[model samples]
Target chain A: MADAKERKILVAVDDGLESLYALSWSLHNLVSQTSNDTIILIYAKPPRTVNTSPDGYLFSPDMMASVDKCRNDLASSIIEKAKKICREQGDKEVKVEVIIESGDPRDVICQAADKIHADVLVMGSHGYGLIKRAFLGSVSNHCAQNVKCPVLIVKKPKSSSSATGTK
Target chain B: MADAKERKILVAVDDGLESLYALSWSLHNLVSQTSNDTIILIYAKPPRTVNTSPDGYLFSPDMMASVDKCRNDLASSIIEKAKKICREQGDKEVKVEVIIESGDPRDVICQAADKIHADVLVMGSHGYGLIKRAFLGSVSNHCAQNVKCPVLIVKKPKSSSSATGTK
Candidate 1:
């Protein structure tokens, strides 16, 4: 087999099963063993919340530090899980890179794809209702329109097989 | 190089350059030479118009037949172009399938993907303004949400390089 061009595929993942499914699908389908493709795992950490709560309670510095620590730990664990998926799926060792950014996931993912000059950005869609999607503003849709590289949006199959037909 | 599992990739094409660019990109990047993948080219032909025009003028059968003929011709040409791209890109011969359907593109594309049981659906994004997108309701976004298989939205870069950054 002839060697194929190496690609840098940036996969935006979170704790959601949808994104994890996308990550595994990419490994099985997109990445060719002959090609030296690098898988970049990115987790967009939601920014730290305001010190004051909605109930008018103020948080102490120690409390804020603990919250930050918890967020960071979660990010690390997510990255580790994604790395394991990449490692276990393909027998050959593939290069793995991780990016944990704190900001709107929409913005962070697009920036990371551009900054790394990724050949493609693979992400998962939440597949929410129109009203909910309007409020949440579909991150996958946003990235697909804004990103420079091709964006692959993988939708997890619905629990009921019948839901697949109706949009 | 190990042989990869063959994939049936369904690419939705139109007369626009954006879709053609996506077709070419897929041929170059997505298909592995070692795998016996088949590229399915789908063209969603717009449904025929009513016999009467908006001016309340009743049209003859000849006029309606001519209009349908034109639409069919356009669809044929588009499919031919996509097939040529698939043929000329790689060194080996890859299987190509064509499907020409008449209906709303969003529905037609999604239905075709599911019917074929495609592993991935590749299409292009027009990347119009938000107001325009709101009015037209982006077809790519609809397919991403509804299709059972993964959807790859390939965005054609703007003529001006500066437009790449700001969403």
Candidate 2:
């Protein structure tokens, strides 16, 4: 028997398609539609965006405003995308909440999960190899070690295995 | 409705308590005891043991044999422990398998999961912070990035939240 209270699942989302894949996977496999679960979709922007340029010069007020607006818009769009996926389920009893923060994703995600007391944290792997270590990636590694609750890192399914699990 | 075929779940376990906690968590949350699923428990030993002297100087052939025997014995003991956990479910239809490999755990785990075509890979997080980085840890991070299938890095339930999710 399932509990009456809602299960809070915090899913970390970004611009990558893998994030959406993780979203759909958790929606279908992990979330029990019969239960009143709350899906908290989170998006974290970099803290430096609000302050200065890459060269350490103080950002102009106009530039700062534009960057902030751009980040906010991106967060809203992704959260809307997640909302549309939830709507497809047609589970009217379920609730969805969106929270956008500005910080390093590795630390921000773990802090958000703890602050919200999330039941579980779900993430997506970017599949970067050793060569790509210089670029942005590896947050999942840090989050897995730091998050207090259970964390599920969903892989982007290959073409052949993509539609197989949905059925 | 659950599938009729068996689900191959490769769980990466170790001598740590987090591993058994992950084992029991999967048994309760992920494993469909009703389904004819196969659980493969895997443990990776370090590539080789360390010694102060040359390859064949300090570690004589007999001493090397004894060390290898001890490591194999530990692996067997852990496998037996995993089997006992499976037996507690009393799911006669469900099968349990054990594998022990010697290599870097990060690379070995992902390779094993792929070789077996595992439906899902389960891992336990030791929650080791930077201070403890000198020791072996963080294999789950690498496995999540490389493993083809979905990876569940289960966090050991905190004392206050341990009994909260059973329902």
- Of the candidates shown, which would achieve the greatest TM-score relative to the real structure? 1
Which whole-number lDDT from 0 to 100 does residue A28 have in model 1?
Answer: 69
DockQ of 1: 0.48
| Top candidate (DockQ) | 1
What ranges in model 2 sit over 4 Å off? A1-6, A33-36, A46-69, A89-94, A127-137, A158-167, B1-6, B33-36, B47-65, B89-94, B127-137, B157-167
lDDT of 2 at A24: 72
Chain B alone: TM-score in each candidate?
A: 0.86, 0.83
TM-score of chain A of each: 0.86, 0.82
Candidate 1: where is the Cα deviation over 4 Å? A1-4, A55-57, A127-135, A159-167, B1-4, B127-135, B159-167
Q: Please, what is the whole-model Cα lDDT of each candidate in the order they appear? A: 0.79, 0.71
Candidate 1: Cα lDDT at B117 = 92
Error of 2 at A34 (Å): 6.6
lDDT of 1 by residue, B1-167 (tens): 13656679898988777787777777766777767789999888877757898899988889998999999998888888778877776546789989998987888898999998998999888633355457759988888878989899987766623212111
DockQ of all predictions against the true structure, Cα-based: 0.48, 0.33
